[model samples]
Structure formats: C-alpha cells, structure tokens
Target: MSGHRKNSSDIHTPDLTSYPPSPSPSSYSSNSSSSKSSSSRNRVKGAARSVAGVFVSCFTPPEEDAHHNSSSAYGGSDAFTSSSDISGASDSTEGRRRGTARGIYATRNDSTHMKEPGSTIFTLAEIQTATKNFSPAFKVGQGGFGTVYKGQLQDGTLVAVKRAKKSMYDKNLGREFLSEVQALSKVEHLNLVKCYGYLQQGDERIIVVEYVANGTLREHLDCFNGNVLSLASRLDIAIDVAHAITYLHTYTDHPIIHRDIKSSNILLTEKLRAKVADFGFARLAADVESGQTHVSTQVKGTAGYLDPEYLKTYQLTEKSDVYSFGILLVELVTGRRPVESKRELDERVTARWAMKKFRDGQAITVLDPKLQESDANGPVLENILELALLCVNGSRKNRPTMRRCVEVLWNIRKEYKDLLA
Candidate 1:
C-alpha cells in the first residue's frame, strides 16, 4: 500500500475470542440425541460463517461494492447505471447493513458518495421519451457544454434535462459531467438548483434538474424591454445570489468555489428568486488541515467574469468567485453584459467601465437608463455600484468575502425599503 497510509487509531482489530464456543458432542448414546446435537452444531457453524462473511465484506472498498451492486440496485442497463448510480430502492436488513458499511468506508477514504445518494436511476430510453426524443420544440437553452431541454416525467413532474454535446463526450468533458453530478447531488439550498438525477449511456450524458420557470438571469437582463425587473427585484436577486455563494463558501462540508458565477449560470424562479446553477467548473477548497490558502489549478472560467489574479497565477481562492459575483452585481445594476463589443475599448469591459465611473464620481453614467428614468432609489443604486467596484478590484485581497458582500447588500435593501415605506 505505497500510497495508502492508515491512522493507527482508526484501525479496529476484531476480537475473535468474543465469538461463541462451538457446540460440544452429546454424551448420550441414543441415535436420536446424537442427530439433534449434530443439527444444533451445524446451526452454530452457519451463524459463525454468516458473521465472518459480513466482516470480510466490510473490508472491501465501498466504490467496488457500489459498482458491483449498481446493476442490481438499478435495473441492469449498461448505459444507465455506473458506479455513479446509487438507487433509493427498498432493501432488506442485510442489504441496508452492507450499504451502511460502504458509506462508512467512503467517509474514511475522504471521498463522497454521488450527489443524491438514493436518486432515481432513469434509463436512457426513459429520458428520451420524456424529452420527445430530444425534439427541437423541447429545447430550452444551450451552452458551451450542451443543450438543455424541458420535459415532463410520466408522473407529470417537470424537469430540465441537460444533454452533453456529442463533441463533448471526450475524457475531459466526461469528468466535468461527473464532477457536476457529485457537487449538485450532495448540496441542497434554496438558492441552489436541485439535481433530480442523471443519465449516462455511452456518448450520451444527461442531467435531470428541477425546472425554474423564469429561465436564466441572463435572459431576463438581455430581454429587458421596459419596466421588466424593478430595482427592488434586482436588489433581491443580488442578495439571493450572494447568500447562495456564501453557503457554498462557508456552510458546506467543504468550501465549494463556483468557478463560473455569471448571469447565464444564475437561474430565476417564478418569483424571480435567484438559484445558482452550473457547477461544471466548481472546485472544493484546499483541505483546511493542509494549511493551504488556495488550490492551485488550471484557469477555467468566462472571460470578463474571471478573477485577474487567478488568470495570472493559476492559483484559485474563494476570492475568485467573489470577483465574479462583483461582476454579476454590476450586471444587475447596469443591465449590461460582462463583455460588450459595441462599446469603446475603455468601456467595452463592463467591470472596468463601472469601476472607472465610480472613481470619477460619475457612477450614474453606468446605471441602466431605465433605472435612472424612474427618478427614485437612485442613491441605493449608487451604493450598490460602489460595492461592485470593491468586489472587482484588481487585487484579490481587496475583495470582500461573500458573507460581507451579502451584509452590505442587505443593509442597502433595508434602507431602500424604509424609503418606500
């Protein structure tokens, strides 16, 4: 075990001496007495063997056991169930014990079970039927990774199915798909999207998630006609997004950095409540015990929203997400895309332009004209713009933590409410 080092304290050596003694031979010479004693001895041996079998099973790796049982747990479909499918089907006492044993082993190994431990495993054919064989009419959205289709399960449950692009079935994209499944399945929060389950068959990979009625925050901003998302709604959205990021950074079992935090990745419910979607580029923070401030890895994120420090050094910290959120805040206030080609060079980058306006005491220039025309809540909007500037600062050290960002937005929101009240 070159790579395997065990903690001595955690290794438990079973006490074999505690086992019951074998049944002794009967002294009586009667044939009937001898037969009964022999039967009783056989029962004792069988019981002992059962116990030994369970103990040996416990020593087997959880992932291996999960793989072995996957076919049985889910209907044996090669394209449908891999080790990733951990079903919620009812089981007997011994089956439960085996599952619990695997869970314990997984915890000891510093790995987590797939997201949604007992999520339903749908067959590829089932998913196809749900989406009308991937019809164009069912298409809801498309991204760099794949196309998302809206579909209804047989039970009338609405779901958004994300299908991986054929070209994206390569090794790198496959890893990303599994990573997203692992992250979304494990975490549950009001502002985070819920992953119902996933489908993986050969080159076809699909994720089934709860469908948010209002589509994406990007869609809202892009299609803003007039008087669509009110200033109050925008503030609420920023707060919602901030709270979600805070949860990922501090409240989870481990810090999760949503490397992609842009308007397109933030979805809205019917009430316009923001839910953070897309964990394809997310990464867990460095182990706390390791005393590492950040996890160094390859740079991967959208252009304008990416943190400059991360782009230069390839070292990712929670501040990277803070920087992106700052850009999103600007998007909420100004209704501008992160990167715009039609504008002049200095103003082409929304974050850079907003920061310049704030520095020049002309923050009003970056405010969406519609917001300015309203002639109310102007001061609150300016305060938010200032906060966004602090978030997108060139130095990561200057950016506030997500918790702090949430606090500032809440305070501004309260002030605006009081004015209206």
Candidate 2:
C-alpha cells in the first residue's frame, strides 16, 4: 500500500518456503476416497520437501537424511512400535506386516501420510541420548501443556522439543495435534511460528519446533528491565503481528481464529521480530449454514485477551481474533500487561484506561514511563497510538481487519521514512 519496495531478506518473502494452499470446502468435502488420499499425500510430501529444503538452505554443510535401510534407529527391530499404545507383537509377525505394506503399489490409507517402510522411527533411547537425558540445563520453558527443551541432535541440528504430559497426549489430543499440523503446514508467514514435526513414543509425546532465540514478546516487554524498544520498533512489531493475523483470518479459505492471542504466545526471533506461536487453542470458524461444520468445544484461550462474544456464546469467529489482536496492539503501544494498571482511584484494565486517555487527547500520559525521556512524539508513535485505539473499539465489528491494519501501518512506516529522510 505504501508503494515502498519490500526487503528481499524479509522473513515473509516467498522464496523461504512455500506454504500449502488452504483446502477449499469442496476439497474438504471430497467424496472420493482415492482422490482425497492422493490430495493429502501430495500436500504432505510438499510440506516435507519445503521444510527439508529450508533447513538445507539455511544451515551450512547439510547432512544427508539418515539412511532408512538400517534398522539401527530402532535397535535392529524392523517393526518396533515406538508408540506405547501399540503392543509388542514379536518382530517376526510385525516385520512381515511392514514388509507387505512396503511397496508403493501396496499403499493404502495410513494414519501418517508416509508409507510404512519409509517411516523413520526413532527409539525413545535415541531421543533420550540426544537430549542428554532431559537435563535441567537444556530446559527452555514450562507451561500448562509441558516442558520444552533445547536439544542438539548428533548431526548438530538445533531443535526445541516439547514433552507433554501423558493426559495431554490422549486420543482427543492426537486429533487436535493433526488439526494443528494441517493448519500450520499451509501457513508460512513471518509472524507465525514454524513447527517441525511431532513424535509419539508409547506414553511419551514430543513436539519438535524450530528454535527461536529471542524468547517471547511478553518477556521482551515486561521482563527486560533495560534496553526498551524504540517507539518505532514497537510499532513495527505490532504491524508485523497484525499482518500475520490478517493473513490467517482473511487469506485462508476457512477463516482461522487464533483463540489464544497474548504476548506470552508471541515468540521473538534473534532480530527481535515477532512470530505467533501456540496453536493449541486455535479453531476454524464454522460455516453459518452447515450445522455440522462448527462444532462447539469448551471455551479455551488466555483470559486477559479472550473475546467477550466468544465467551458468551461459545461460538468463535474471525472477529474474535481481531478483538484479541487489538488487545495486543494496546499492549505494544502502552507497554502494559493486559490487566496491569497502577491507577490508584480507578484500577481499571490498561485497555480501558488507555482508551480513555486516547479519547481525551492526553494519551501521552499512558506512554511507557521508560519512553518518556525519548522521542515518543514522533509520527510512528502517533500512528501506533491511533492503531491501538482502533483495535480496542467497544464493538468487534468496528475493528479493522488485518489487511486494513497492515495498510495503515505501512502508511505510517512510509511517513516515518519520509520524516527521517
């Protein structure tokens, strides 16, 4: 919208990895089993190639794929079921089944898109050895789901492995995991986190993610005592995040509502760029007419940013994500936690307090105290404050879509460029 040339090195560029195109309603409802299976297989292969290529291109001295011919990965057991749910049938019996299913001609619908023979099954011990027996030093963070650790593979690839509690890996959880994979495989955006793969071994479950070094936006905003971001940088981050959400809600065929949108879930890269993470609470907006489409589930999401309409009706829509994104914009603008407020007389949430000040033309009072001494009056800051106000409007329908938000921010960025030049 600004007519400015975009950076070739920008993370959002297309050459990085092609995102799977979202499946249409017709594709989703395809009646032909063979056609659907073929489509699914094509999607899976495309995703795998893209991910593999990304790692190869970025990390120097690329390594070959671990040879699958050797049974060494699973301790010489040709048909060992690493999943705890599967029983230990003798290798003689299981090996025959695997061999019969080996040839591409004999393929049928399998739970994992990959043919049985080509599947690389890593033993629990292999992971344990790779992770140094899950030592405390490797621990990254703990959340309601589980603990994540930074692991370096024998091949020297860095990965973030999440170990989930047994209950969280139940059958229902697996379905959700598949859905999450479907959602992420088709989405490649700078502001969205990248998921590598998932593994299930007996009772243990692991989610391997691309390791991002900068940590979460919450940590950067609230925890980092010194080195606060310049006003321009903060606005840039807000705009980037908004653009990502815009892509999710508007670009996808079935609009995705990021049910949980909070600073803690927004991870930062080494460059201090933001990427939305944690899709456990995300859901697709159900079609209005198809009663079967939008199944209602327990209301899930972070509290401070949850949508009131969704909370009231148990029905979520894209607007719900817009509402949450608005709250995030407010957080970026004020450097205040969603709920934090020090106002003595009126201990209202920062969103309300900031909006009040914004309307009164005294929004400067709500600026992060640390920014007071700096050049906070610049056009970038003014545009950011205005965007924050638009995001937090009382009515959800009044909020701008992510595309509109991106355009507005792009304009502001152009203004900033002109001012500087």
The numbered model that scores best in TM-score is 1
lDDT of 2 at 295: 30
Model 1: residues >4 Å from true position, as ranges?
1-118, 224-227, 373-376
lDDT of 2 at 99: 12
In model 1, what is the error at residue 48, expressed in angstroms? 34
lDDT of each: 0.63, 0.55
In candidate 2, stretches whose alpha carbon ends up further than 4 angstroms from where it belongs are 1-126, 168-179, 223-225, 288-296, 341-347, 373-379
lDDT of 1: 0.63
lDDT of 2 by residue, 349-389 (tens): 66666666765667677777767543435445555656655
Q: Which candidate has the highest lDDT of all?
A: 1
Q: Which pairs of residues have clashing backbones in candidate 1? A: 115-185
